[model samples]
Target: MAKIKVVLIEDSVVALEILQRLINSSEEVEVVGTALDGASGLQVIEQNQPDVICTDLQMPGMDGLEFTKEVMKRFPRPVLVVSNAVQPSDVDNIYNLMQAGALDFFPKPTSGISTDYERLKSALVTKIKVLASKRVS
Candidate 1:
């Protein structure tokens, strides 16, 4: 089976590495490109044309909501939001992200202590595969 190509957009270097490792652990997923900010994220997405995009909701420039809107407007691909923010407002942001055309959202493990990597990995892989199967229209 062809692996699901994924582009990761995150501002934190550490979180980005963690996410990459988790996603690559799945046999069905591949990390084709990565970026620390939304502008570069758009560039990489355009260049790679990956099957899905996983992005952080909070970033230095052009947050995930804005990125999702632009990607939906220009590229129109499946977007899965992965963010560290878990507060009420952050949770509410997921709705906005969806409104801007995100396919789903995954909250990062709080406190930076991930004891359930396997479960998270499984869920992310499953979401990626499912989203990749859906047509934008």
Candidate 2:
């Protein structure tokens, strides 16, 4: 099978680096591009036409929600929201993102989140793989 092409939109430098590492390490996923803001995320999306977009909940120049909405409206690709603000049970944002055409979401690692990332890696990879298999059209 082909590797999943992924575009990431995250503002934090540390988190972005970590995510890039994780994504690049996976044989099934590739870091096609990264954007620090939502508008640029859209531009990267248009350019790469990735299989999935992994974006943060909060960002400048726009936010994950608005970017997801616009992306779905125009490009119509699968979106997987990687957010730090969401609690395990509080999946309101996930639903909201899904409503905006995102396929699903994963709780992102925030400050001092090394342990969280190690624990969440398998589930995150699995979800991204599954979502990437679906056709947005």
Clashing pairs in 1: none
lDDT string, candidate 1, 20-66, tens digits:
99999888999999999999999999999999999998898799889
Give per-residue CA lDDT, model 2, range 7-123, as digits (tens): 999999888987887788788889899999999988898899898899998997799999999988888878888887655675687678778888887777656756766556667
Query: Which 10 residues in a row give candidate 1 its minimum summed lDDT?
Result: 105-114
Q: How accurate is candidate 2 locally (lDDT)?
A: 0.84
Candidate-wise lDDT, in order:
0.87, 0.84
> Which pairs clash in model 2?
none
